[model samples]
Target: MTDCDFLVVGHGLAGATLAYVLRQRGYRVLVFDPGQADSASNVAAGLINPVAGKRFALTWNANELLPAAASFYRELEQCFGQQFFFEAPIFKIFGSLDEQSALLTRSPDHPWGDYVASLATTDPGLPGVQAPLGGAWLRHGGHVLVRELLAALAAQGEREGWLWRETFDWTKLVTDPTGARYAGRVQARHVICCEGAAATQNPYFNWLPLTPNQGEVLDVECAGLSSAQVLNRGAYVVPVGGGRFRVGATYRWPPFADGPTETARQELSGRLAAITEQPFAVVGQRAGVRPAVRDRKPLLGPHPTVPSLSFGGGYGSKGVLLAPRLAGLLADWLEGKAELWPEVDLRRYAALYRPAAGS
Candidate 1:
């Protein structure tokens, strides 16, 4: 009945990446995804920024995650015969003297301080942009074409008979002492639920404290901007294709009504307008709920109750940079080789769950 060694739910970056890694390891993998509307990974700008504003701190695990991510995506490109990942510096514009001072103030103690260099006293070629106090330059940080990568992975999965295109039937799902089962049917040695925000619905893990963030982005045509470096001000204006750019994104927590709304669009548009003086046209507007957690860390590893079933999500805005590395760790843990990240391991939240009444 269509047996598979691994069955991964959700075809977003997390799911696709997990499946690809297992397949590379020579395991029989099957993916279940319905191509649902507006999964967070689909709407992500795929920016891998090292230094973030609002404290100018290095992203969590930026040093290790960045190199691992670069090597992983480059290898995937070679295997899939495609070019979607590009290495470009990110230019975070300083809006005022205070923000610039804040940046220089924290440079010494910051982990990513090495990548943080003051604007060279010479012309850097960036034009038509406001640089009040100039800004920091990050070397290893760059962008990945998320949509293209997803499309490639899906295509590759289809060709290899590793992908099953359909909504995951929870009723058909079963777990026991041996391992996880799909459709009350096909037995797999491992089953990972990379279902993004949908993890909040899983009875076994619902109480783990998932904070879904509703975010939106505006796709605009910003013609004549040649430099592909990600432009960041109040909001990030990331170039996508055909002189078009994806600008975003506003965050709303708990009580966050899912899906795109007019309110979000106006807020995002206003933020973009405030940052750039160049004429821009809004071509599209989209939104999705990111599966963020309270500690701002991703949730990975096995289910607290169901040992066989695992989860990999809650990456929030850093899904592009975080998922690949975490997916590899999941693979390692499943294969019994490596220890899971304590910050992401599900056991960290075990105190919240009551262990299903009794053992």
Candidate 2:
């Protein structure tokens, strides 16, 4: 008999949530993670915005994903007796009158209108903010305390003897139709890789187009800023309590590198400046590579030939808002309770998989 029903690799948002869902479904799970400080989930601001981007369009599947995310995190909160999800309004400061008019015109009739809490034609009266063109207060938006949630899950997993603090070694993994064995000591009926950006290097599934991108964020102390709401202009300033805010994310593609860069710090600082005139001091900076997919959709499902091996990652910047719901869907698929949605199913890319030499 296998030691566990599923062995999950990586304890970031994707793996942690998947493991929890599986366990709730009565499956024994073992999560392996070395707790990499630079993992994308750890560095993410955990911002949950239903509307985003230059067009300010509703996020894909926002209607379903947002509610699922809230319920999942709330259940975890009740289970752990610790709060991780924070619901607050996001103030989207418009850069120009055209932008303001566009949202004002569409918000009244568009489906995205449901998420618009209010709109202002004049400055929203936010201190230290530059919003001459006014803005929109988007409801159902907030940030998650990601690290805290991960820690709580890990603590519980550790206490239950299901969490292993070690890096997953590909060479030590053996898989077949029946199951997978790790280092000849742990046997699991199935193995799922949730390795974030690192999955691009996964020998079995790297053939899929996993475009990892580097992103950076800065932690700053802005004394006058309101801690009750998120301010979004070109860059987002998320209040993290005690007058400290997480300001981020500069996106860089290709030629990815590790560690924070001075260029990114300056870019973030500049964006923060554009958002607010309040004096602030940069206290910290973090950098991580986001596991983005070619089509900007999450990758999920088992290897074509190796049924025992599976993958669940590439949620990109939307991991926090998307992981929980997708985790449930993945668990459902695993138990043969339902089929994966066609778009996210790995079978969509089956033609791209070419067996490695000597495989």
- Please report the candidate that would top TM-score against the real structure: 2
Can you tell me which runs of candidate 1 are displaced by over 4 Å?
108-111, 119-125, 224-226, 355-359
Q: lDDT of candidate 1? A: 0.80
RMSD of each: 2.2, 1.3
State the weakest 10-residue window (summed lDDT) of model 1.
119-128
The CA lDDT of each predicted structure is 0.80, 0.91
Candidate 2 C-alpha lDDT tens digits along 5-124: 999999999999999999998998999999887788989999999999899888999888999999999999999898999999999999888998888888768668578888898987
Per-prediction tally of clashes: 1, 0
For model 2, the local distance difference test gives 0.91
Off by over 4 Å in 2: none
Model 2 per-residue lDDT at 56: 89
- Models 1 onward score TM values of 0.93, 0.97
How displaced is residue 106 in candidate 1, in Å?
3.0
